[model samples]
Target: MWVLIFWVLVINFLSAQEKFTVKKIVFIGNEKTKKEVIARELSFGVGSQIDTSDLAYSENRVYGTGLFNRVKIWAERDSGDSSIVYVWVNERWYIWPFPILGWKDRDLKKMFYGAGLIHTNFRGRNEKLIFSFALGYDPWIEAEYLNPWVLGSKNLFYSVEVFYQRVKNRSKILEEEFGSFYERHLSFALTFGKRYGLYKRFWGSIGFKEISTTGEVPYMKTLSPSGRDQMFVFGGGFRYDTRDIPIYPSRGFLVSVGYKFNRLVNCDCFFLQGGLEFQGFKKIGIGLIASRFFILNSFGREIPVYSHFYFGYNERIRGYFNDVFEGENIFGGTVEYRIPFVKQKFFKWNKAPLEEFSILRFGVDLVLFGDFGNTWFNREKVLKLRYLSGCGVGINFILPYDLILSVGFARNDTGRGQFFIDFKGGFE
Candidate 1:
């Protein structure tokens, strides 16, 4: 009787242990991101017996992708067959609507509203499509497209874009003119290249662009001589970038050279431009940028259209307006001190409300910038060496979506101050 009882207890314990083992996993609450992607990142998988000891590790794997806002796992016992494992996920919404505010100098000049829809993952493919529109108070619509891949390869890439924009400008001497203009632009580029060792990269591409415009003249009458003008450009260039990121590069160098034929069929003019960028650091980060441009008519005469150089803004100097200074030769540099400010993590993986990850990072940057450039119809006639300098403070926020947003204010040597905001993806 005692031996029989011991045998029965042993059988029951074995059955219970088998029941707790996981044979399969089922995923839910995924619409944009794919299940296969999440599965590959997970520590647990089908046919693997469930181990409560590794639950935390499993959760961390899923959260690292930044695709989910929440994730959950559970199991159910089956009466006849293998136990069923359930993986529950909550998806983050893919749409955002926000306001846009910008200023050229110090005035709160423009107020606009914008909306965007992003699909980081679509149809199990890691593809993204974004659509955005902005309506200025003057009521203009600007649209653009960013296609990271067309051939679907990491080495070869293509980007095609079309834009239509209209705006009213305030005349320099006369009163404001409600001048309306329509512009249609199309650009296509093909690139092939590779990244070398750490801190070295090179890529080259040939591109074509067409720009046509019809509108009244505002600010500059030369831009529209006949009240309507059109330009077609074809060019190819080689680009070498060593920067950590193209948008907000922390360190690296970039060099590009290109020649364009403007009004190819009509005006028959040639334009050449080249630029070099250097990002380096000793104790503080420093960025240096310089460019030169030349334009010549079919008859080999210099043209005024290509006689100007543009400087300022996030591209060259920080804490400045877009295209604030114009010349034929541009030289600009910025020095910044990057410092960590705060960091906080939230959205526990087990308690995640959606199939998304959480990230928190904060930093402060002190920056000093200088810009100098000259413009002339002839290269021989250029401004002497002089630079405009400014210094500022900034705050940075790094988010899970690989987004970096920065806000800053800087004052020039002339006592004029400017406030600016910038953002970039992939790198800070």
Candidate 2:
């Protein structure tokens, strides 16, 4: 009996070694990009034998670049040596455009139109350029441009961006007895940073921002009030990311710290402010995010508009609008589950579709959210704890554009519910 078991194990081991072998590799459709560059992105290479177990890992490495729409790998045996490996990739276009629409209250709605263009591998050097513009119904417009490059003879990456924005507040006669004043401002920022591998991966950047806004609103001018505030921001923060993707991080912690100098354009009080953010999760697929801000100065203190203490959209909870709760010292959190389904299969070259619009996916989440922050100074005393508890379901569609359109619905404890329909990037 012992001799029979030994003989069976030996035969199985020999068969496994004979099943997989690599001789050479050929890459097609990569002109401006170096073949070696693409080869390094793969988990398997020339002279290395391949197995079915390694296929998914190789596919993920290339698709993670956000530059390819489709990738296919094939193996052909060479009667001379061993087996020749062939890798074929279909690249996506560099430029794209889209529109945006969102809702809050029935009376207060928001709409925007925007487009962006990105160029990868420009001039045969692995550099990127991005340009975008947005215009909206709330009477606002913004434009920005970004350039990122890996520094000469170094692994360091740097980027520079310029932005301009203007907004006007319009009143609804039926919604309120009095009208609301508008806000207009102009601002500019400059940023620089480098990536490092510590206990985990991290990126740090230092930047400066200058913003000036007008104080005279139609209502403020008529109602005897102080006008306008101007602020200058100079600070630096480091971000630690363990997520697989930067744009849509599934697991990681993102923390930012900054200081701002706020001076009323023509007033007596000038203040200094500090901010912090904490975001991270466990791989069992649960995530958490929290942020806070504080101000200290010779004059009256001011909380930055970008600072929200607890409640809002995309921060602690979904199915809500941005900055829904205006206040100092806000906090929010979310719990989610991520489950994946589906396996890849091979087909004839011409018969295979360029993209899989939908890959099998399953996700369910329970959320408990609340805000204990307020916008006005000394208004913290009046801050009430508003809480909402709900559950949500999502459907994912994977496509050539790498965009995902998710339709979700949630019901709150208050008996009020919300239905959300939005694009989850990389699926649309």
Candidate 3:
């Protein structure tokens, strides 16, 4: 295929380049990110043999940090067997204090709007800090921090989060027959992670969680028989990513697996849940083909209804509204093809601060995608949920703040279609 041919050509080209010892590694055009942080991401340092393929990997790693608008890396041959590797980066605005008005579901009717302050590269060390409050259908106040290196150890990483959320859990089955339930949850967690080489990360976390509901459903009696539901939870996970970019990957593979255990603090309720996700991307000519697969499951005592796996919300599928289905297990797959229509910089400004940092560039991408999924409540009912599928097309606007605004139209197998708007690039 065209993708295979492209890789073959790239391999041949890289093989033809004469490897040289790196005399020095230099960074240019970075205004906020620390040079030491950038150097740590490089595959080759001074006195190391510089391979073109390694340079490409370093470029991808730097770009993946989501700190730069453009990354250019090249090696200039020096005298004898040495060469100078130059890395030039156009830094993005790292701090964003912006208003947030967005759909709680893909549907415009369910709205959650708020304002938040986010620092993507705190202190120029690739650390992230976020504080936000959202209102309307699902309301929450949350704060989180992420650091790839803890205590200056490259292999040690950590993340901490604390949040309080009030959610109205509406069920079509409940609405048509009984009434909806509202949940108030408060939780806090801290996680430690260790890096295994360049691509794999292992992490574990412990947390306290509490759930209180305003109304009871059919499953509530089994969920919190003691009328008090609190839990001490523990979880662990691992991830492997080699994508060209985290926001819009054009190549490479990503896989993650994780599990959680809940031990009730006030009741006998206990359960275990786990998930696995995989994504792959391939460049073929001018387009990138991407695919995703995921599975979610729970075992031990049946999980609380509020803890059940739900799909059709957020990233599950394009044509469905939020939380359309719920079950103990869910599985799905998606395939998409993406291509940029405007690959060139559309314009630029030469104003004061804009002149030095203001390279206003614009680009648009086209996406065609299809998704298929099913959910299950029990072993006997595995795959019993009717297969749901959707197909859609979208226009993505590339903009400052590392944002991708998306406008899309989609139709499901049920012959229902809708128009949706969304943004990409945020911690989940």
Candidate 4:
């Protein structure tokens, strides 16, 4: 009996080493996504030699596209040395025509709202088209398009964006600070990018910007002919991302280094700015830990104060108000952990077309996060930099369409704390 068991184990080990040919590729639940688009992202195809490693990488590549909420790959053996690869994906809502509701600041009284049309699978090529008109504090109307694989090549992509906004000066809005006013700005930009290897991207852009102040802006006293400025700006950057899911990664690493040159075509000022960013994610037991570090520096000639870096807005640091700190050079990072106490599949539509697709999935997660950072205008002020730290706990609702709604309580170094709500989508 021992000899028979040993012989069986030897045979299985030998079989596992044999190379298997990919006989066919199949996709499930990609209703709006074109077959070619799915094929374009896969690392292996028909007649290719596939092993366990290839299967795992292929699944990750598809998930990294942010096209689906879940992806599962499996193989069905065929006659001798051949097999069929099956890919199952839960598709997110491709078309989103929804109302945009948000706050201009941390204060609930300053409400901002609007409506927009956002399409993720534009013509089934993984293209994005968005048109939005938001009103309230900083009113703006924006239209943008991003193509990840221009001309059907994974190595190239491009984006175009146009916006007209009445941006409010944070200092003025706070009332306690100086230089509060509104600026009317119109801008347009076109960028082209290239991808290298599996995780690197290089991009360049050319754009035009026009800005004019309304009301009183006390800080303009230091401006170099600052009343109204119009200029043509050009620059480029590089990014490297290996996150399995950018919005909500389970495990991976990301690095981005970029430089931008702003040449004042209508003025006498030009400056160069560079930035570095690093992010890491890892899973431990049932929870996941993630961290991000970033540094932004400016040089060349003096640029508009508006071009500088400011933290405490959106996702940068959670405990402070928007524009809490501003400077020419800024450094900061965050560490967060997400643990899911309840993870279960809800219900599945069993109707005609639904039967052909994968089932929907959902879960509830608890998040603990901390953030710290500071900004300074020059090296001399580095020692005087006022650093702020904050820690918070939050609840995350995981739903279909790669949507996560998070609400958390954060307490900063100021001994002041607030509860904040955040809406996140997978496509960014």
lDDT of 4 by residue, 39-74 (tens): 766778899997876776678778768777677888
Ordered list by lDDT, greatest first? 3, 4, 1, 2
Against the unseen true structure, what C-alpha lDDT does each candidate score?
0.45, 0.44, 0.76, 0.73
Q: Put down candidate 1 lDDT per residue, 41-91, tens digits, no spaces.
A: 555666666554334445544544445555666667764455677766666
C-alpha TM-scores of all predictions: 0.55, 0.60, 0.86, 0.81
lDDT of 4 at 376: 72
| Top-TM-score candidate index | 3
Estimate the TM-score for candidate 2.
0.60
lDDT of 1: 0.45
Question: lDDT by residue for model 2 over 1-428, one digit each (tens)?
Answer: 22233233332112242346778888886656556545655667667777744554455455556655556666788865468777776565544454444332222345655666666655544456666666674333444433333554343555555555554432233114434444555455555555454213224334333433344333232111343454454445555543333333343345555555554444454555555555443334222221222222221354333232334432323445332443444444343333333322223344444333222222322222222222323344434545444445444433333445545565544445576655531200
Question: Model 2, 247: alpha-carbon shift in Å?
Answer: 4.7
Residue 215, candidate 2: C-alpha displacement in angstroms: 7.4
Selected candidate, larger lDDT, 2 vs 3? 3
Q: For model 1, what is the alpha-carbon lDDT of residue 200?
A: 35
Model 4, residue pairs in steric clash: 172-180
